[model samples]
Target: MEANSNIPSSHTLWSPHDTVKDAAESLGIALPDEAAKNLAMDVEYRIHEILETAVKFMRHSKRRLLMTSDINHALEMLNIEPLYGYDNTQQLNFKETLVGAGGQTLYYIDDKEMDLEKLINQPLPTVPRQTTFTAHWLAVEGVQPMIPQNPLPSEIKSIPPFARGATSSTLGNDITSSGLSSDVTMKDRDDQSRNKNTGLSQNASEVKPLVKHVLSKELKLYFDKVVEVLITTDPEKENLKYAALTSLKNDPGLHQLVPYFIQFVAEQITNQLRNIEILTTMLEVISALADNKTLFLDPYVHTLMPCILTLLLAKRIGPASKDNNSSEAEDSLKKQLAVREFAAILLDHIIKVYGSSYSTLKARVTRTLLRALLDYSKPVGTHYGTLLGLKNMGPEVIKLVVIGNLKIWYKQVIEDSNKTDYEINILLNTILDIFRHIKVEVDNAENTSDGAQSISEDVKLKLEERVGTKLAELILEQPDAIAIVRGIFFGEINI
Candidate 1:
């Protein structure tokens, strides 16, 4: 058979004649035309066959590039001796040298020679320790023991807030018991059976709801002690109250008591409406809880909001004016204003932090404040709280709600003769403060010095028309009155 005729054209485009002739020359063998042709085709066929099998190995290994080891595996499968000195990871570098005259070139492997003497004198490598794992129960009879041998569950993955509707001590899913019913538990079932035997199931129709979390006795004691310290008439316990607030703000692992704190606040505020000190203390608790980084308070923010809004927008936070003497009433009024101020701050913080959790939370809170602020009958204290809330909502709320409706509220609530001069002055100062705390840097910030020092009588009437006469007169007192006035009507910096 003719080897050249049998060789596929696809396998040998350049032909292997030159390679075979060089090999025969090195061996000092005689070469003939027919023998060289046949040998050349045969070598090409064999080389192609080896690469085809290597390609299959590359594909089987799910690799795009074929490695040297794949060729060796293919050679072994074909019963051929693979060429030595080939490593899968090592690169084969070929150094080119200029050869005989005419600028000819020769390329060969750039192998680095090793020193056998130096290698033999080197220190022997240390033996690796044997691989070992100790046997330990991860969980015994459904309860995970807190041991160093077992990894803690928290390190593996984070438990999302409110993701677990219910949990069990024995809720093992590793080829063990099924889940417990939401409405009942194992202990409840046992108690029901005992009750039935004693003819008591007739009275107890259903089991009470399962506790969402098990509160430790230590936490309950701490909570009760904190509440007692905060509400005690004894001024000596002020240190203890400060310590409790500090712990509530900085301590970790207090997630279990978040709901209880919110509840304690709600109940205290309701029962102690007439008591300013208690109401202020409760607001402090809410603020401390919000500041705690470890507590997942997002789930309980909705429940805590009512207490904040109540304190913020309530008509009267302290004793009725008619029931108390003038001095006592004045002091109580200051306390009321303080409670409302703190409540407003807390509400603004909650909306900013958890606003993304509920898309409409900010909007709803803004609407509530607006309603209280716009109502002429809602007392001056309510307007003060709402203004503070709107101010804290950011520049936009201040610009749109507070500044836009300042005329109506200032004229109706601020100028009301029914309210005391002290209350009116306090509210007026708050209006000025809304402008003071408002930090809007206009493009005309540089031009404030260049602009007119005072508002002319013409723009003054427009300013008074914009915000009530009282606010207009006060705004004119500032050096940047022209810029503030421009920012208000022309959207420059008034808010």
Candidate 2:
């Protein structure tokens, strides 16, 4: 076996002069001299031959003493990575050979056939990406992994490659010598596949140690790479940015990244960012993040208020050119439409998640959102008209978002629609919700008891009659608004 295991020659790996020809073709230049031609032609083949020799050394050795000591000694003498590339290729092949051996072991013992590709490509659960943004501690070897004792700079650290652990020499040698999981998609499958090679199938419960090991070591590194890709100028990076945002939205543990997303929006808007594609993507991500109450309001609600208001106003104005032609206005319509759709979705999310806490803010936003819807006389601005169908269902849950800021709503709707029936109905519906809130307060304040009638019957009758009559007049004048107004007064509406 030893005699037959001679290293393959350069001639076996590469045809003479092929490398020089390929190099010349790639560079689009001719070799200047014979020495250059000879060096270029044979260099690649020489490296391949040396690696082949190292692979044969491993195959023939009985004790499997495939040592790197000789190569490292050679590297030190050479003062560079050897043109040989033997150590690198040896480390790779030793494992492949071991996996092949392990496949044989399984076949001999259990009479089961192995499909290398399937064994390698199986999917595993990924750690939620949001977890990386949190400043949580990790324990290793009964001690917490400490941050630097000396103060470090504020810049984010580049994650380092995984280092061999304390037990690596003993456990690692056997493991590294045996085989690799054929899957490159999995971060550390070879180490994970060890128990299975020993006849233990890794089920969800059994995979805990592998998960912990990878999460503690590799997850941070992977996330850092993702972040790097997301912020780059490469067009391909958009896919990564989308994935990162989606992961952030789904992750419960990593709430801190939510602010980073808000900051990304702030930065884009401040720069008068032209990448509308990214803006739309950011909007979708924000809408997803807003699904959680803590995510929607914490650290973001205040900043988001101003940003949303500005964007919505810009959208209302259409495009910036003063030409005032129908074509110009028509051309600008797409941006406004996009803004309206995004704003509706975002506002919907906020109302659902923050509920009453966001009521004061909602009132302010409602004026903006409801303007086009309420102003029936003025052709119902495109933004409001498109979203007017929203009004037909019921009042927005956060209708009282502005609470005492009734003037904003009045000015926007009344100024825009002096005689329109739709405008009148919108105002009536909103006023009804306020009245319902007032009634709730009054009822709660005076707990009814037969012995102690809370207030004079006359006073109660007057208040109810006044409120009911005003509501009736509004409803009679605009019957379409009746459902909303009644819904509000009876507290049947979500808001």
Candidate 3:
């Protein structure tokens, strides 16, 4: 019998007996025959357990092939220290050698040591570049875009068909079934046979429908023409301008053009700060778009709010014409005030219509207007715009923001020693208008009450002090100031 006849053929052929004998010889000790067999069996069982655990790591990493790191991780999980100096990226080469006169072959992996000096003297590798990312649409509206990132249609069609039916039919069969062509039936059958031979279905392969986005040429031309007429500087095109505005207001299929119009308006407002005509036209466009019941403006309210506020609070608008009389300047100021008032009305409409949808919309608008009002660097016109903007926000905002800040603002900014009496009176009258509105509400609240409208004298004195001496003096001058001030401070009446 052969020397290896005692070993079972079905069991693993690799034996750890040689490794155990070699280790004992290196230590100047002899491993007995029976002791070597028992140690070899123990080592084989431990290796088998490790390999089984390594397979689990392979599946967890979504890989079919086992790796050195997997074995190391398995060893760590089993509470055993893993072997070092094994590079997972390098392949291991095993050498077969004949041992002694018995002609038994031994397979051992070769692990050569590296020279420390040579390794340290080698040139360093170049540093790698930093990674970056970019974004593009892989699919749109349920169809994959034909970009480099997605596989081609031909590649997808190359996949072999199975027992399941195809998702769609071919063009030839579609034509033949529809009775559009009579002679193509034989050719279609021949193609079907060929497809079946190639493991494709006889039922035609499915092609995903391509959805194309297309804007009409006429609409594009109309959009361009309308914009041209609206922004024209020629005095003769005033009628054309009105026609353009009218078309925008009533046009049915202008949903796509709405963004373009908004962008155009924003650009024009920024570029044409000195052109009142352009500014006016932009405002009109906004109004017309807002009034169109068919168009949805909710998504764009934040974008539009800034432009409207700019019109209301800009320090100077329109060109200063040369050699202007006082009357001309006054008329020009009136025109600006009119624009601000119109913008304020539009803002009021925006808040009323869309405020409930956006939780912070009202607060954001109120803060912006208040900031503009408190900015002392701004001219009286800006201050007036801020005042009008606050008033249009309704009684609650006026009571919360405008009423509390009025006395300090009037004393510091409105009563500037350099300002003319006319300007000061204009500012004071605007302040007084707020008080007047509050007074009307107070009167109504008092008349509707079941009991007499009354406040303790001490509480009344404290409320007067909070109103500040300047505003208190102004309030006392009014006919029903006491009732109004009490109602306002106590929140019994809305402003």
Candidate 4:
């Protein structure tokens, strides 16, 4: 006879002897050992056949795992009846039951029957209450109130040395700030320093000291309100910002606020350089303050110069974009250039308005812009802005300072392609435009200066040497380049 290769081996998980024998005996058929073994092998082969079919269903369903429904389908495909009461509706809960005979353990599903009316009659649990809070006095006049909620007198901390006389948090000083003595605040500071050096503990007082300048609470409130409105980035706050700027410009009582505003501008510019909006707003603040006719800003003009100059001469103004090719980078570059231009305009305004008060203001500002203009290390935008500033100062400045140095500066600017052509073109346009205007203005001042003046070959070469060959060519391209160059040869356009 042929070997029955389908017979279950010892590795069979469903042991043929124990399980198959039990199933057979349950049906009153006392299965012999050989018969049990054969039945077990047939059962195992059938199970494998069903599972193989089920795997195909699972794959067609785009699933990695086999489901009960897949097995059901697989049984139908094999022309065999599928088992019931084992599905994925819920997890199978097995109840442990031990038979007393041999202490044999068996697990079975426990589906308890319930009284439907009893379940319906059960009452719901009570609902929870909403939350509430109570308030108490924490402190008064910088001293803790002796309330149950506050610490006892003995538990209170000592006042620090500098804070001895202050009433406002940071703005106040102690008894010294009482307006009784001028030097008391300074001396108290010395005492605090000495205490620190000697490891002495200075008790913090609950008493807040009076602020310096004895500034009214109204001033403090106004300063806070103005700063908040100016610094906000919300589009909805535009009207509020405009109102705040208007108040800064036109308010007569802002005399006391000038120094504070200057200090605020200086600090913010230093700390928030990347925040283009805030930086631009800060410049607007300066413009408003300077525009205020009622206020005297002479003492603080020099103080404000550093902030403006930083903006004017900064290589990059706003936050740098992550990708150079992105629109964000282009926008940032444009905004930064605009900021430099604004700073230039503000600088010119300050010189024109306050220049006479301080005789050297105009001269110093001119020199600064000239230096920045000639500086090849600066970005192209900066040179362009500097040129704008010179033009704003007067027709004479552009003629005297810019007309002579255009070639050398522009040569290096174009050679280094670090800045984009858009920037370079803008600069070139500005220079060309300024040269054209200044020539017309100078020549017009002399007469209808449309007449092109002649120049010698030697003068043209000198012109190339002074300003590079490329610039000489562009200058010659202009209608009045000869007249301008001829004027330069003579004393018509001064350097």
Candidate 5:
């Protein structure tokens, strides 16, 4: 018998290449070529219609139980990305049908681990009875940039004054120094320009001319509702994290809500009573913010630095103390570890962009970041993503921190006999770097000085003893870093 072709090809997922011929062989439905083609098209159309409907439903669905598994799977199949509230517009993409929905319901889905069975078994009517075969067409999606050029939402017209002064030059310099591809360079430039404009409030609004703006009130209302759900007593409700992030996305001016968002993240990382999933989501939010420099200009940008630093430092300090009654005492060390590593990257950007404008912020940020890097020097606490950031900020910045921190460290550790050979070795390398940059800057400063008096013997001797000789040895050993050292020295002198 000729194969019937009403059924979809193969018993598994459908691919574009699957046709009536394969469908007929697999599902035993036979038909003429025209009929088979028409039927196949109909099936494909139906599948898409179902998916569109699913996506729409998931987008605004308030049913938490349904969202965790069934709705999530559907989203995965549909390839719909969840929109960050920071995104000005929400798009409901559909091919054929299922476009008509009752209302645009603001759905919240935390991209965290959850028990699919429990979610399904919940007593909510919206909860799935079984994995709805058709439900696989739905999803809440991930965040994407509204425009190809302006990857960040325009609402963040400028970074906070201090943050802009701190990160712009550093972020740009790092990108350029690292010899990154053109795309990365362009992005850094855009970010820097935006940040530079943002520093002066008068120009902030004009920075992002084509920024996408949505109805801010509607988004705020939805966010408020989501916050209500988050604080409620529902064990199955896990949508708050995404809701908070999305809320910030829609109305970045809702920067006031940043504290609430930070609190939520803190609860996840510190509160033993909270789910690990929440903590993981916090990390995701931070990574997202870091990846998009545009968002770094938001008013909440100031708060983020300390928050990130605390998280990194917490890791080094170890887990919460078992005996502590107050949760603060238990997690203090963890908080420190959390901040230490993360702040390094943020500061690196701050120093590179704002140049001398960020002197005050740079000093504080560098002090914290340098200390963390030195502390974690065995492998350095931060991974490659942020390491390249430190390198871009220049060896001088690193050296400055080293010279500053080394004294403090020596006072605390060496005098107290608290550190080991490993710690001392790390300090040595940092000091070596500092000296190299210092020598370069001094030479450049002297060369540019129009017949200035020669340096006093005493100052020269002090510098030579402190940094020059060691710098020479290290430079001779690794010539590649000499250029970087030279760049920092000359850059500072000229400025």
Candidate 6:
């Protein structure tokens, strides 16, 4: 068979026969031309293979520059002995040598040998510093801080001026003085020069805007996977749910996905109100996102608050079972209560975490709950939620909202006989819970005159009357009712 004229016998990447022959001569070996050519091709192929493996090592180390260790590791991986005594910090310099009448060229590494005696006397090199890390704010509120650790604006403008100008203004002003007509006067020349200089200054002042960072495909895939796992209901997928929550809670780059997560939670909560599992999961996702210290959720608090409030104040959450058994009813109620309780906890967390960041957050939450609570037409479940929501805001909120409107709310409840025993019990328990925090101070009547004790008794009666019959009766039933009433009216306890 004949070979094609266009194809070479071996890869051109291989070193020339003369260079291989020179290497063989240095070792006192006389190599044939065919052997030298074969050895050169083999050496080239081996070097290519080693480099391919070395690139893997570089990528694994998260480095761009291929290091000496990477090459050694690649060699080890290939079951070959690594090159020795090659200092990674030092660059190898090669010297060129011309040989024979043919003017053939050969390159050899210029490795200077050192005397053993002088090397042994040299002091040991200084130990390299241990790797350490220091953290600083890379950016705040979407703007990079001009810190010493960050690159300067000039350094960041690394793109060529021509590349930047190509994307900028299209209008070009050629202000060469030679282009001016011969008939132009001195005044015209001066004006043209001044305008040209002004145009140049204007062009110099213009700057190309920084390109906005976009989410990478890998990040988008990760986000979608997280959202899918979070909304999954299978019991076996709990690990996925946990992993998704952990990622949402701890990932630093989730700022871009904050609005998306918020919207997801809102949409799921709206669509899956009857599915307690989904509602709870969505609430959990929101809570996890809120817990992430790196995410700035203050901007989305308004959007998030309504979803949380809906879960807290929804009339129905878990589905009611068709079976009329007491156990099923109890189970349904329990699930509803659990969902509301979780929502209340989330609400409290959001308020504490972001109340100061958003100045109107607390007020806005309080107003929404108050409106629901005071509405006479609202369902009993909503009233229950409103009371619980106020309860979660702490004892001070309970006093301001619950205690202040107790009489009016009591009248409404008393007039409405349609309200169930369960609803009435929840409302009463909520009131008692608020009253429990009100500490009563008793006057030192035993040490004082009888006149002081009579006055204290009168003050207690007035408090009982003001609180109305039902609350007074509930308070009086307690062992320290008189003292409690006296404290409510005359004590230093602030609302």
**lDDT of each model, Cα atoms only?**
0.73, 0.46, 0.72, 0.73, 0.46, 0.72
Considering TM-score, which of the candidate structures 3 and 5 is the better prediction for this target? 3
Per-residue lDDT over 167-240 for candidate 2, one digit per residue giving the tens place of the 0 to 100 score = 32333321211111124424354555564355633442332224232243445565567457555677877787
Question: Model 6, poorest ten-residue lDDT window?
Answer: 170-179
- Cα lDDT tens digits, model 4, 1-495, are 144444445455677756987788789887776777777777888899999999999999999978888999999998989879887777778999998699999999989689999999999778888787777756542356777886676544364444343323322233112212236556876776576556744563345645456579999999999999988989999999999999999988877778899999988988888999999999999999988889888767667777887787766678877776578877887888889889888987887787776676677677777777777887665777787777777766765787667666676777655776677677877777666554533444333233323445676677787667877777766666755565445463332
Q: Mind giving the per-residue lDDT tens digits that candidate 5 earns over 132-163?
A: 33322111122244654432544444545343
Q: How do all models score by TM-score?
A: 0.54, 0.33, 0.58, 0.52, 0.31, 0.52
Compared to the true structure, candidate 3 yields what TM-score? 0.58
In terms of lDDT, model 4 sits at: 0.73
Clash list (residue pairs), candidate 3: none
The better-scoring model by lDDT among 2 and 3 is: 3
Instruction: Put down candidate 3 lDDT per residue, 1-495, tens digits, no spaces.
Output: 686675333233445445766787899988775666677777788999999999999999999989999999999999999989888889999999998899889899998789999999999999998898877776543357988878787876775433222333432233112211224656776787676666745575655556454569987899899899998899999999988888888878787777788888878987887887788889999999988887878767756776787888888777664533366766676677777878788888888887876666777778778877887878667888888888877778888898777767776776654665555666777777766665544355444332123545565465555666666666556556655565467455322
Measured with C-alpha atoms, the lDDT of residue 204 in candidate 3 is: 55
**Model 1 pairs in collision:** 487-492, 487-493
> Scored by Cα lDDT, where does model 2 land?
0.46
Q: Which one wins by TM-score: 1 or 3?
A: 3
lDDT per residue (tens digit) for residues 1-495 in model 1: 596665334334435455666688899987765677677777778889999999999999999998988899999999999879888777889999997687778899998899999999999999999999896665543456888986577853463222322222222211001111223445565675575456634454434345355578998898788778878878888888899899999999777677778878878887888888889888888888889887777667667777888888787787777734388777877888889889888888888898877566777678777767878897777877888888788767888888888887777876654787777878878877777566344665544543444446677777788887778878877666655666666543232
Cα deviation of 331, candidate 1, in Å: 2.3
Q: After superposition, which runs of candidate 5 have C-alpha atoms over 4 Å from their true positions?
A: 1-259, 266-283, 290-297, 312-316, 320-340, 350-360, 363-401, 404-416, 420-464, 468-495
Q: Which pairs of residues clash in candidate 2, taking residues 3 or more apart in a chain or in different chains? A: 98-178, 99-179, 359-401, 360-401, 363-401, 363-402
Local error of candidate 3 at 484, Å? Answer: 5.8
Displacement of residue 437 (Cα, Å) in model 3 is 3.4
